[model samples]
Target: MNVNGGRPQLSGTFGAVSSTHWLPSAAAMAVLEKGGNAFDAAAAAGFVLQVVEPHFNGLGGEVPIVSYRASTDRVQVVCGQGPTPASATADSIRRLGLNQIPGSGLLPAVVPGAFGAWMRLLAEHGTLPLADVLDHAIGYAENGFPLLTGAADAIEVMAPLFETEWLESGRVYLPDGRPPAAGSRFRNPALAQTYKRLLREATAAGGGHQAQLAAAEDAFYRGFVAEAIDSFVSTTEVLDSTGRRNKGFLTGQDMADWRATVEESAQVRYGNCTVHKPGPWSQSPVFLQQLALLDGFDLRRMGLDSAEYIHTVAECAKLAFADREAWYGDPDHGDVPLGTLLSAAYTEERRRLVEAKAASVLRPGSPDGRAPHIPEQVPDVLPPSRDHWMNQIRNGLPTVVRAAEARTDTCTIVVADRFGNMVAAVPSGGWLKSSPVVPGTGLSLGTRAQTMTLEQGHLNSFGPGRRPRTTLSPSLVLRDGKPVLAFGTPGGDRQDQWTLGFFLAVTEFGLDLQSATETLAFHTDHFAASFTPHEAHPRKLVVERDCDPGVVEELRTRGHEVELVPEQSLGKVCAVGVDRERDLLLAAASPRGRQSYAAAR
Candidate 1:
């Protein structure tokens, strides 16, 4: 819906924020408009998201950000990825008789790092006072803004996912136990107070941004923040039932021990542009593999919207992701050969296997691991249909759609300013149960317990002081020796699919940022190991209301199970680009969710 009607006018002076929710984007861009630099805008945006996108980023969850400092030409990768307490190891859990992980247990929550990550950005990159940057979030929290449609939908979806106490969620969500109807104002004085406290804490650091950041991180993880959380979690029955000693590691040591920094980038050539992503630990390398696999194709002759082109892409994506699922994980814990996977020689071999006519049975072609013997085919599950005449499956089978919704994920935002400072951030985490805000501090600890595996020997197995392996990867791409595109989407497994589609739409097919953002999207569910995609494909592809149905049918005939979703169906994705020749910044933000905004000074 160009319901935002027209993009705000652009000037040489530019600033913007892209996120799943509109309000946060607006908050960040507004900060930029008022002279705050990229770091200031991001911190402001992060706080606002904690309110508007509460389900995605409460004080409880962690954040991992990749930022590039233009002046120094150095890229700093902040891990802010959370760690399980020094106490709760997979070996510790195994001492008990229970062999399987409980679906809703609290034993796995790790130390969340989002707040600390924000603190560090302010320390290293920002010039403005932390309190000043946080002012907008505090006001929004205390004064209440009208509920946007997106917020309302997220709440309705969250009802079945969170525990009863969460019905309150302080004030960002429902105060009276009902999600605000669209357009209702919502304010949580509790959250407002929390923001105010952080501002003071930042000010007390009494040194440059670095000292202030260190202090802020300490305030949350190692100091008063951890103590308060430990107390609140102690009162919760979920903790007792999960059979954990105390809340996993929502403590100071976990935070104190935590270190978020950028890893080395995997460099791959994408035609004229050079592709870069932090490797092995991140699945971003898969994008490079897919593009490389398709390098031999005559994309220009395939016609941008034709079925043949879509078929090859769908098949190529499945092939790339099939490799991802079998190989990707924490490199320190797993044996993912990051360098070999991106090698041109390897990708070229994989591409030769793709038959020009028939759909190949999808499978993991590369040997990234030492698991087994034969090459195997990955199965494709049929997408579900809401209009199916048969309500129940044969013999009373339960629906996969219902099963998958139990695993909703959030979105990613990537912004590059004219000054060349940039950020790649993914925001996520939600629970049907309440994550207690450590008592007096009122900060809810993140429930990262499920991210770990119950098996003691698996690389990603649960462990004390180890960060759970996550699917939250946001990547950056540079064309012709300059950063041109920053893109990502939110869906545990669907991330690769959406990102792949958007990239081809822009780089190979020449679509504008808006068209690429609005283009058809689908994913192979291999990562989740279940066929439940956010939207079933072949039968489903999120398209604008104006897209032709015949086009949808053609996609289905070519092996894409197609279904039509809401106009703004795909995850909200925003990107900033440069018309390198014109020296103009091009930015676009999705109107899919509430409170999204972008501004160019």
Candidate 2:
């Protein structure tokens, strides 16, 4: 390891894998050693992450994938985000006497999409069988893996609720009527059995690889998994963040009706590289927008970690994210104006908004002469005391609190193989603390619907069969028409900010992959967040504690409400890149959480 506690960068010609956890990184490398391609390895790693990092992701969550296929010389997005139930309308939610969706429980459940997305990626691009890719995850879930400290604390916080309300969750998380201790061996036999049954159903079809994959998808959506979720939601009324017990709106038909789709990526050209991100349905294009705005600036001269660089980036991020709140939504449901938002004229106009000092307001630009509309900001009604389980749930995985908050963010996976395939995926939601686990499946539904607004006429208003604008964004960068880097981080609403800083550090500052991943980062919460009870803190900037005191004082002098946090508390960025000039592959993982790791041959 380096003196700064970060691992040494790994370089090779064979393959590389980086993720937020060590088990999945190693498992992905194991798949690559077995001659599977990047897609196969990523699928394997994704499943392992679900089992090992249950606090960050599960089978019932969502994942938005951006991949570059060497064969086709194409980059495409696999949209794994599920839509709201057909009956979950704004009026219906209002009838429940709630102003905003709860941050936890069944009422916010969306159709589980992560399993289908993984199956789709494997079926299309992978050279390995489904059974081969799934065996490692099954082994971990059946046998056991050492429980993480973060996971242990989450279970302990929710222990009271488990013993009283969500009994099924208690049965799985509290195996002996108590929360398991950190570093102790823990197993989820129910989840293991769930995957076992999926495989059994797949193989029973007795066909080729594609047929078996199709069978597995059917088992999860139109079959037993769907049935289990429907039965539980239909019959159960569990307590939620609203201080009321309510049944969910999801149905078996919703699962049967939805399937992950493959769409073209929204991209922007920055110098020699072309960066690709998921479409407007995600908060992805905000990254591209920031790149567009920064293309006019001379960041290299600003100097890395200088007050000027940090202020410029944070200011640009505020404007870009302001547009995200005002205009981004599911394009299939309404107009997103993405083409105009990324146009040169709009970018140039928006770039002029960044000043020498931080601006203390949300300012979304007009694209194509359209007026911008923003939802009403809701103030956070935090519990009177931290003893409430709802308080813990709000601070749990998939949610990023403000300064000095818990470290329960999300998870990321980036993989590359010698075959030239590259993949970046952010798999999150369906956290253990987000909802109660289904009895037999040992998995819970995601609260992604809470990210959507209930206000009518908003771009991201709640509606039937609409994908909520999610914070999960992955990035793939290509140089000279070939994939060179796959990178992303796990920060709710701040994903783009952290990843953009990493990309610039590597591209402009000439830092190696490891150095870029380990660099100190800063972000601003200047716009309304995408999580429940959307709140904003105008002009607030958070920097790592290790930042130069001179720079901190300079930022404070320039109108930024600067707050300092531990050096490693900001970003959990992971990256894998190809050095075509050297004919080598490189990988790096953040040392922030001490859990992220990178593996290479």
Candidate 3:
């Protein structure tokens, strides 16, 4: 009867299925089906993610989870992303001119505590035994899970970065003298050994939930892994002296002080649906604010493919992203005016400046202080035209065949049991081959440097001890004081953007979860910011095929840099649903992944 038994573990109302790279979604749902709560399912999935989606998540990554209590209707946000070592400093990497930090794994990497976050969640909400919850992962690592297309592609492209640098990496990734192919079974005995030791240590400590998590955190920070990582990092030129990034002095003390915080949600109410996202760690809220301002306009009147609609949204996106570039950063270190940015008064003022049926020139500048009066519309600054957008497909698109799809993996698991408990979790920003594991302990440290800006003082600028701005946003949608939808995506920075669009399609457009999620779309900045667009997709509206040609030409006339890409190009979302009225739970992974699926009861 154990979900962790030899058969494929699964749970949920509709049975779990998905396109996620991690196999843990099935394990978690199975835990719930076998009488485990959402927490148990999440823990089971968390453990499996470490085994199957190893390059992205492990004992060393960070986690941010969203939980909804069915009884009290309380929604809680748990910060899962870990912080930089206390000793880290911005000055340490000054010579690299900040750019080193953005593309950096060696100089700007921080202490990852994804497992620390998971440990806390499981201890607080799980009913299954810790060892039992970890069984699916252990089995996979001991036996082997095939390298699906997504993960394999990543290895082929990025493995050279690791194989040439670390021996252990070369061994784990190139066991047969090449990266594992799709359907080629892969096992990680080293990671299994690490998890085994950690579980044993946690179970032995014996304590309440908080204490249990604390004990597990201790296992990695001050125990065996710490000693090993400290030695490995110091001898290598991975970090600098301050332990800010791959500072040469990675110490147990640094890892011990690493903490994850759960912050309040940034909320947007459009009609009956209230969109929610974690505070400034991501750019989702800023986008939401822009959407609220645009609510007063008639998007349908502008039409779907009209140049007016696309240009309006594009300009708004540019403005929002500019603010993100300027003011978004770790809240602990900087003052982000999130409250003021989303204020209705400011939104109303912004709405007033829009030109009806036309486009305006976009200037990159910070929003001014709140003004008492709405601004007059300035005309002819930028000319707009009626450009029709070609919808490649309104529903689903044929994903472009990609040779680069292999380097990524992520899993999202949502749970709602009879008790009304709900959880949404997405792990790892996908360090992949960038971050090498610590010898013996398999400590795959967080490689968050990739998401941050290297420019000095930019909100997302990389600093020694600051958490990098990430797009890994796990969210919960509460309707009528009840949690209705819980979801997240796995496309690095694409997570927040895609999530914001889904929230809008559902709340503003009145679509159901499936309809909302299935809506083919373009990212806010299109391909300007998130360059990983889907030009190869057959059904999605990408820059190349669907822009009505006239729309692109018109936009180009206005000084906008437009390119074609597919909506599902980079961000593949995995979601779980709860139809509380029907007493049904729907769990499904994206079909994009060859091996991904959901099994629930």
Maximum-TM-score candidate? 2
* Pairs that collide, model 2: none
**lDDT by residue for model 3 (151-180), tens:** 565566545545555566667767777778
lDDT of 3: 0.58
TM-score of each: 0.82, 0.97, 0.81
Supply the global lDDT for candidate 1: 0.59
Global lDDT of model 2 = 0.89
Between candidates 2 and 3, the one scoring higher on lDDT is 2
Model 2: ten consecutive residues of lowest lDDT: 394-403
Give the per-residue lDDT digits (tens) of candidate 2, residues 1-601.
1224446888999999999999999999999999899999999999999998888899999999999999999999999999999999999877876777777898889999899999888877988988889999999999999999878877887899899988999999997899999999999999999999999999999899999999999999999999999999999998877666889999999999999899999999999999999999999999999999999999999999889999999999999999999999999999899999999999999988888878998999889899998888564454465546766555324542334773437799999999999999999988888899998998989999998888988879999999999999999999999999999888888899989988998899888888888788889989877776676789999888899999999999999999888777777889999999999999999888789999888
Report the Cα lDDT for residue 433, model 2: 87
Q: Top lDDT: which candidate number? A: 2
